[model samples]
Target chain A: MSGPTVLLTDAAPAKAASTRRSALLGGGGRALLGLLLPLLLAGAWEIAVASGFATGRLLPPPSRIGAALWSLAASGELWTHVAATLIRVGLGFAFGAGAGILFGALTATLPPLRWLLDPSLQALRAVPSLAWVPLFILWFGILETPKVALIAVGVFFPVYVGVAGAIASVDRKLVEVGRIFRLSPLALARRILLPAVLPATLTALRTGLGLGFLFVVAAELMGASEGLGYLLVDGQQFSKPDQILAAIISFAVVGKLADTALVTLTSPLVRWQDTARETL
Target chain B: MLSLQSLSKTYADGTRALEAIDLAVPNAEIVALIGGSGCGKTTLLRLVAGLDRPSAGRIALDGEPITGPHPGVGLVFQEPRLLPWLDVAANVGFGVSDLPRRERAERVAHALERVGLAEHAGRWPRELSGGQQQRVSIARAFVANPRVLLLDEPFSALDAFTRKDLHRHLLALWEEVRPTVLIVTHDVSEAVALADRAIVMRPKPGRLDESVALPLRRPRDPAAPASEAATRTILGALDRSLRPRDAARTPELAGGSSF
Candidate 1:
């Protein structure tokens, strides 16, 4: 038993190193595999257009969407729309996620506050993000205020739920350790509670960010111009399928990029956590 | 010195976990409370550490009554219980936060070095093996330089070899710091090996059954005849403590089986 245990323990580090190396080696191949299906769909669409099976004017071939993107970029229209949408998302996400974390922490820590707030907030969360569009437009008008506020409202619920749940579910044993050490309530929160809940909260923030884009699109659709949502509406009004496809594709790319950026930013904070992995 | 006077603990559900437990440990003495499951060994340790209040009695450290978690007491739970976010050095320094920064760092370093984990100061708790993590927990408990150290089956989770190694390490640390130590464990050999006195406890409204003094010299060998005899004595006491009062009157069971 001793001999085998020693051998197994000695092999563990080497096994971990090999696993890390394989992960690094497989990164590019995994990314390529992810892109394969989308590329196949685009190719098939292009072939169908070329074979005249679908009219290019109605469906817009891959080439036409690419050309639309190029022209939008060259004329600087793409940057304006992208920048407008991104600013709203950035501002709204900051406000919503910030408020969510604050209120969630308060409610989770204080039983009376939780009792007073959680039920109403949960009910409000059940209402669709679009339901607030007309009300926000009427209250704040068709300016960026309504759009940003709408996005904020959309971003708030998931983050609040995530943070509250995470804080409530922090390991009781760890909390006992803190109490045994005689940590002050504030010190306990700063040292134990915050770090324990961070991973789940970051995941919630990412979800909220995705929802931020969706709400911004809905908000922009109801009101006046100057966003990817505006470009999407403009394309429809002019009956240009290429422009519409261009806007939709850009949204998808931007959303993916934003999610990736968030993951990169949060990975280091939660590096100590033991995340689940797919076995090879 | 640490003293527990008539300490009793009764849950709200009308179950008595401990009853009139009385014990005392002079300064720098090592004592072990040995018992079976549901014998309130952990409850006694917790009460002594000021982590829980006794229902009907008092625990005093250096003649001061313990009302809540006090600086004079340091506790190492059965689990290492190191906060996952903190590195080894930070975990060691956790209980000693009132010290000056440089002093805290020095104490943490000294404790880690004493536990033979100096090089692991920057590693996370998860990166360490179970034994190493337990060592870190010992480091944390000792770094505070408390008047008393409470260990609740601290080595019971480790494999036999690691457990032996930690016993040696714990003895070394005790020799160096010489804090009054109360270790709660069910392992008879462990009590015989590390403790100056082993207090046998009985279950079902836990109470002290007997106390056995170990007169073996330092660097005691677990396989030695004296240690084996002591282990047998404690086991015999524990077994006798477990038998029903009426059974002791029966002729056939009067000469109970020896361990």
Candidate 2:
């Protein structure tokens, strides 16, 4: 027995050391590769505008958008709109994701609750999220309350779906392992259910956050406001194509940045995952 | 002692998985269960583990009945069933979570070292090979100091060499704690090498067919003549179990033999 064990230890660490991928095309390299095509397209659009190939009207080029953004930054106008949108999204996400996990866990563990809630929730899912806008404005008085509520509603469904689905799909075999250990229900949930559901839950949160941005546009559209959505409306009312393009570009960049930040923060939670994401 | 009294199981769909089975496994004895598919060997193991209900009979550990999983009993499945989110040490420590921190850590460390996994404690389960993962599960089972261990083909997925290696490791661990063990396996040599007796079963409504005692001494070599003879005897019993006529006719013949 000792002989075999000794042989195994000797062989395993060597294999582990060799499994490391070459450093040349690592994580940084892949990120840079992802940025390549978008940078090329943006450069091409900028040049097309600069060399007099197009009027650069109605469709402002990258340089004009950048200038618009730069002026907004210098005059401190961009900060106010950006701050409002971020706060609404942050608050809505906290509320929505929190309730999602709570109810998701409840419905998953209790069949009675699932039978009672799942059908109505699914029906509610079909109602266009924006359909709540007019009613919400009338109800909440065209304030931050309505906007945040709308964003929270947008963020809720996916997270709820994710939590319930993740819990339902957790491997029964692993649960048996918990049972064999005589784990208490609370300990079983903490030790097994929580970790098992984490990966999918984080994914759902990303989906919810993305929807938060989408609903923020609808929310700001409901009434007078300071936000990126307000910039979209403002640019259109004033007929400033440059500002509209700038706001649109800001939406894309800010959304991507927020998603990136989320993935970075939660990556450590699922670091034990043996998926392709870790390898590439 | 771990005992089953007239254990029987019938599923909801009108299938009799096990019927009228009686068994008594004394303390510190290792019993290997061998049978064809649907023989209810795994079903019997599950009953004893308290993971399922026995329709006709009850399982007892010592003098008390087992209604649910007990801290005194530990089970290992065909797959590792490890908590992939946890590292090796944490997985081993999971069963003893109620213990004092110092005692739990000490037991986990000792079990890991016993199973040749002390060096791999910090590593995630995904980083391990199939054999190593099984070893970690074995360590997890022992960490709680279980009095009876149930193994459901724990090494069935490994290669021949790895399986043989694991048999040795498992025996070594068994020798230390001497827990009453019930192992379900298709491998005849495994029965000869590890079990004190091999219980063969008949299928459909699975019942104990023959009990072949392997009186061979500890650290039995698979290639030795005594071990080969024991293996052949268990294989013969397994072969006879496939036919109803052969089994019903020879009720008392294989029950008394030892190699």
Candidate 3:
């Protein structure tokens, strides 16, 4: 009995190790598959341009787009535009998200404050960000303020709703637990409310950032001399298809990277919740 | 000591949960309130814990009227109710915020050690099994060192093996800390196995029916004749309380009722 039990135990870990190794290989294979379609498309585009089936001026080849990107990088124009957009997005996101969280906390916790400000905020939220653009440009006179404010307005509503709703729906039983332990109001907010609403709030922030990117493009299209949006307009004016494609590609890559960064930064805080969901 | 006098509770919609319930628990005594569902055992416990206010009556702790959540009272709910974000040590230390940092850590450690969960102190609540989470809740309650501890069916959710183990653990803790304990449970054997006195309650107005004193020694074997006898006595009282209502509904069956 002892010998057979020892053999079975030894066999179990070896089986587990093989399954883990296969899982890693499986992930890598899927990633390679994801790249296949894009590479094939690029190849087809290059072939079409080379064969003169598709004109280079209308739909630029992948090589032309690559050359355009290289020229921009060499001139240092790419870095300045990218940096400007990043700074605007960063500043606007901080301002809008900070105010959203504060207002959400107040409205969710206090009935009087909710009654006073919630309706007005809801009404304002219904107004489109574009509708604010002309008014913003008039009020702020094409300065950085109107552009930044547009992005902030775009980022504000989702975060506000997420935080307020999350706080409102916190488990009553857990709040009772806090009360039973004689937790002060501030202590309860810090320990219970904040942790409970964190996952939802982070999701809202991700969505808000995506919207921020869209608004930045719209803002830059108005009167901006720099940023990726300017490049798109400039390319359109000059009929440079390569430059337009480059701008669009940069947007996709940067948006993806920002979302990935947010997830990586917040994953540790929500690991317990994720594990609970998985087990369930 | 904990005392309740003529405690009654009627909901806003006119559902009477408990009526004129009177009881006195001496300090360091272990008492169990046993009843079927809707028998006001939990209502009584909640009133004592000051989680709900009595419609008409008073509860006092050592002659002081209980108003809100009192510092000397601790409660363990049916579910563990441990915060998922906090690890075991943090949950255990939750109620000891008034203490200095070092003292709070020591208290949390001591409580976890008592429940045999010191090794799991760094793990999240989700990482632990159901029994372990309940133990963390117990550790949380005991860490505060309250004068009166109220448990509302704390072990009814566990499996038999785990429930038996927790019963022993609870008794051992009671022996050490010696807080006045009021446990509300529906399990008759649990009542007989743990409490020095069991208060049997009945539904339809939810009043106390009888109190059975268990003279069995500590470290009781539930299968022992004495423990079995106590269980039978409490079950018999519950049966009697339940019989009259059934008899009233069906007159024909009441004539030959064996119960």
Tens digit per residue, CA lDDT, model 1, B179-199: 999999989999988988888
Model 2 lDDT tens row, B1-259: 9888888999899889999887888898999999878888888888888899888888899989999898889998889989999999999998888899999999999988888889999999999999999999998998877899999989989999999888988988898898999999888888888999898888998888878998888778889998888888888888888875653365543354664
Task: Please give the range of 10 consecutive residues that has the lowest summed lDDT in model 1 chain A.
Answer: A271-280
What tens digits encode model 1's per-residue C-alpha lDDT throughout A1-280? 7999999999999999999988866989688879999899999999998998988788888999999999999999999999999999999999999999989988999999999999999999999878888888789888989888888998999999999999999998888788888999999989899999998898899899999999878877886578999998999999988999999999999999998899888788887877651120
Interface RMSD of each: 1.1, 0.6, 1.0
**TM-score: the better of candidates 2 and 3:** 2
* Candidate 2 Cα errors over 4 Å, as ranges: A1-41, A44-48, A277-280, B246-250, B253-255
For this target, which candidate reaches the highest TM-score against the unseen true structure?
2
Separate DockQ for every predicted complex: 0.57, 0.72, 0.66
lDDT of 2 by residue, A1-280 (tens): 8999999999998877665544535777778889999899889888988888977888888788889999998999998989998999999999988988898999999999999998998898899989988888889989899999999999999999999999999999999999998888998999998999999999999999999999988888776569998999998999999998888888888899998999889999999997755442
TM-score of each: 0.90, 0.92, 0.91
Off by over 4 Å in 1: A1-25, A275-280, B245-259
Candidate 3: segments with Cα more than 4 A from true spot: A1-21, A275-280, B244-259
- In candidate 3, position B24 carries an lDDT of 83
lDDT of 3 by residue, B102-145 (tens): 99999899888888899999999988999999999998999889
TM-score of 3: 0.91
